[model samples]
Target: MALQVGLVGLPNVGKSTLFNAVSQAGAEAANFPFCTIDPNVGVVAVPDERLTRLAELAASKKVVPTAIEFVDIAGLVAGASKGEGLGNQFLAHIREVDAICNVVRCFDDDDIVHVSGSVDPARDVEIITTELVLADLATVEKRLDRANRTARTGDKDAIRERDVIEALRDHLGDGRVARTFPGELPPAVARELSLLTAKPVLYAANVAEDDLGQGGEARGNPYVEVVRKLAEEEGAEVVVISAQVESELAELAGDERQEYLDDLGLDRSGLERLIDRAYQLLGLLTYFTAGPQEARAWTVPSGSTAPRAAREIHTDFERGFIKAEVIAYDDYDRLGSEAAARDAGRLRIEGKEYVVADGDVIHFRFNV
Candidate 1:
């Protein structure tokens, strides 16, 4: 399975529209503030043409692709850290996710009211980022106090924790995000804190229909450009999409959806971009396992070792480790079948130390 990614933005930024369109979960979205009070989660399958092709080649009875859980949280406000609005209630929802997808309103709509009175992508991003930073600041400060109290007992671990929390508090107090904090954090500490700002961010610039197809790059949209520049500064990715267009696309099917996308001068739906970007943001890759029974896709971190990747399938697979019979996807495609690939020596045996690569067709050899 893919990791969870949260969709967040200020009110009226088309966040729920995108979520509803992508997940088809009918997240309640209206033209007012706080319409979506509860977090709406939708599990979406990650699409891969390789899985379809492999199924055909192997004559598999079924196909299963990895999935991601998308959480649509309530809109944030300027003073959310201080419990000014519903933002505080929903910020906790974000802490449950692995990464963030920040939706920015890049379109101007006279009918849809902007929470800030006008559409300003830069300001909207700042408002949301600042709130997250402030909230994390409060969290670190509270943790630091406890750490300091424990440090008084002269516990080595407690003393080290107090030092790290102190630095984090100083960074957040200066309006700096945890992601940009100076050094690497211990994995345990990172898991314990779960700072919102520390999560990787992918920007979704919600543009108008006309702006969506402005050009191949879609840089003609001034509002989208603002978001693009901001994402660049943060070393993030920007996906240009019109939430209204996506909502309309969700109602379409088969040829109809393709025709509509062609009419929009787009080759794919924004949801595809969202899924693709989310994987990249999380540093994930996919590998496949195929047979006459089933063809399935699996998600793993980019540099995962063969045994580590096996753990994703089952802990027992890792515990009783041996070797993995692997075929490169391209080799399998050229050889036309797994048997042919093995006969042609395109299949290789990988050991525990073998690092798994993306697009590998793997069959693990293990014992309990």
Candidate 2:
């Protein structure tokens, strides 16, 4: 399954607009709250120039890029945890995603209405985060009763899980996210809890087109700076984009799109940057398989084992695991061919224990 990043923010913060730009999917971008009742899902190919070059070198007929799934969830509001503003449904969508893209309003447009009646990035972030925290708190508290019961029966695993739940409840009570719960949580407990706040987040600061240049730079516009500071405190990443501009760009194709971006003095659109950041937020890596048939990119976790990566290609490959003939992308590109890379001793024969690296050109050798 493609890893997904869920778009979340208060109503009318351009989440749908940004989603439309990134995926080119026509999600409803209305100006009112609860406009997007159902989550809009779109799969976008991850842009990697290396895959194109590799396909050319291998004379492959097709080049397929790995994809990321973007889910446009409805806007979140205050008291969402308590079933306000379709909060229950929205929160469920968030729980289904691998990461969160929190779209915050940084532009001032009197024409569009703000749910809170003002454009305050920091305040808006607080409102959304507090609700997520509260929702998680409710989840933890509910589990605590059952966990406490099991722990009382003297099950060692149950005791450990109950203790972790207690710590999580305390962390949420203090207005802190599960991501900042001080120490590493056990895998069992972490999987069981699946707290919304524990998921990685990237902040998309929705700015006006005039403020685009100022949005991403180190010293950005004051509104972006406010969001930057908040992200800094939480160890999250921020990408600034003009949803209106992206919406416009999404309508054009080919050279026209390039011309539009060029006219704006941008090498690439902010939506592209946001997509890359969203991919990174999940700590995902891409490896390649190139041949005369096809050159394709496959997604895996950063430190996935060779066998695990083979499973991404096919369960049979992993079932009958053997060695992998791996070549680093740069080595293959520099050497000009896999044959030359082999002669130069740039190819490696790795076993199942080998941890796959990003940009690796792999040829799995398996027997089923």
Candidate 3:
């Protein structure tokens, strides 16, 4: 399954605009609030120049890039936890995602309405955070109640579970997110208590065209400062992008796009940075399968075992476990071919215990 990320923010923060620009899925982007009533899902291919080069080296007939899923949920209101302005429904959509791309509007456009009536990223963050906290508090409370009932039966595990849930409830009650907890909770416990704010966050600072290379301050935007501080405290990542600029950049032809970005004094598209950050946030790594038939990239968690990585390709591959022929992308690029790399002792045969690395070119040897 593709790693899922939810785009969330107050109304008119360009959540849908950034979604359309990244996914090219033509999601509704209007000046009105709550334009995206239903969640807009788009599967975007992760861009990798290394994949293209590997495909060229292998002389493959088809090249497949790995993809990530982006979900553009409806605008979240201040009282979304209480079902205000499609709030509960949207928060449900957010709960289903693995991570969040919090779109904080750092741009100013009188034509584009701000749902909060002003641009205050700190206040916007508070509103959204509070709603998520409220939603999580309700979820944790229900779970705690159920666990409390189960605890009376003298199930020691249930008592421990109740203790954790109550602790989480207290934290959420204090306007803190579940992710702020000190240690990792069991997956079962986490699944039972759907915590909205616990998901990893990537702050997308929506800036204007002039602010492309200006470190998000050309417009003297306040959200830039607020997001920076929040990210610092949470040890999260942030990327500043001009949605309007990227929308226009997406329309240009290949060479023209580079020229346009150069004209704007930008090194690369904010959309690219956003995608890269999302990929990293998921702890995902890409491995390549190169052959004459196809050269493809596959996404796997960073520490995925060989068998687990094979399962991502096909269940049969995992079931029929065998050693894998692996070569780092850099070795292939330097040594020119698989045979040459093998002859030079750069290629390796790894077992099931081998943990896959990012940018690894793997050829699985399996018999089904």
Candidate 4:
């Protein structure tokens, strides 16, 4: 399963709208705050053209794409850690996610209200981040006291763990996210804390349709500039999109949507861009399995070895491991067929330790 990313922002910043567009989950996109009191979870296919090409070449009857989960969380307000504006519940929902998508309102619509009475992307981001830091600080503080007590008993492991907690405490005390915690924490100690701020985050700037193309390398939207500057400081990524426009496009079918996107001077949908960016942010890669019956895309960490990638398909595959017959997607595409690629000696026999590359086609040779 693909890792989940939580969508969070002040209410009415298009979190639900974006969620509905990407996942087609039909999350309620009301204008009022806390409209999404309960978290809405949706799974979306990770857009990959390679899977389609593989299916065609293999004469596969079915194609299955890898998927990612998105959770639409209610808006957060100041004093969230202190139980304001359903903050505790929202924060609890956030704890289960692997990463965060902080939606910042960049468009101005008189009909829609901003949570802070004005649109300030930087201030909004600061508010949400500060809340996360404060929440983590509280959690770390509770852990620190017990760790110190255990260290006082002359336990070496406890002493090391306590020192790690102390370093994290210092970082949180300075109102910084756990991802920026400078010291290297031991694996056990890090898992023991599980601080919320430790999760990677990306800023989603919801712009007007007119400003849709003014982000990333081409800077046109002033609000996107503010978000970009803040993201640079935090070492995070920024995905600029018009959620309202994408939501509208989501209602249309393939050709209709493509036509609309073309009319907007776009080659692809913003949802695709956002999904691709999130996939990269999480350090994810895709590999494929092709056969006469099915062609499927699988997601794995960037440097995953052959056995590990096989385990994603089935534990039996990993337990009864053997060599993997692999071919690069490029070779298959250029050769026009798997038979041609094999004749060209492009198909390779990869052992257990062979690291799977993105767009690799693998046929697992397992005894199980």
Tens-digit per-residue lDDT, 1-368, candidate 2:
48889999999998998888878888888889998989999888888889999999999999899888899999989999999998989998899899999999988899899999999999999999999999999988998998999999999988987887888789899999999898666787677778899999999998888777632442457888999999999899998788889889878989999888877778778877987887688888899999999999999988999999999999999999999999999999999999999999999999989999999999999999
Q: Ten residues in a row with the worst lDDT in model 4?
A: 212-221
Off by over 4 Å in 3: 214-222
**How does model 3 score by TM-score?**
0.96
What TM-score does each of the candidates earn? 0.96, 0.95, 0.96, 0.97
Better of 1 and 4 by lDDT: 1
Of the two candidates 2 and 3, the one with more favorable lDDT, higher being better, is 2
Which of the predicted structures, 1 or 2, would earn the higher TM-score when compared with the native? 1
Cα lDDT tens digits, model 3, 1-368, are: 58899999998998999889888999999988888999999988888999999989999999999988999998888889999997989998998899988899987789888987988888887788899999988988888888899989998888777787788888889988877887566689888666888899888888878765543334455668788888898788988888898789778868999888778877778877888888788888899999899999999888999989999899999999798999999999999888888999999999999999998899898888
**Residues 80-125, model 4: lDDT tens digits:** 9988997999998998888999999988898999888989888899
**Which residue pairs come into collision in candidate 1?**
none
Off by over 4 Å in 4: 214-218
lDDT of 1 at 359: 94
For every candidate in turn, the CA RMSD to the true structure comes to 1.4, 1.8, 1.6, 1.4
lDDT, residue 127, candidate 3: 87
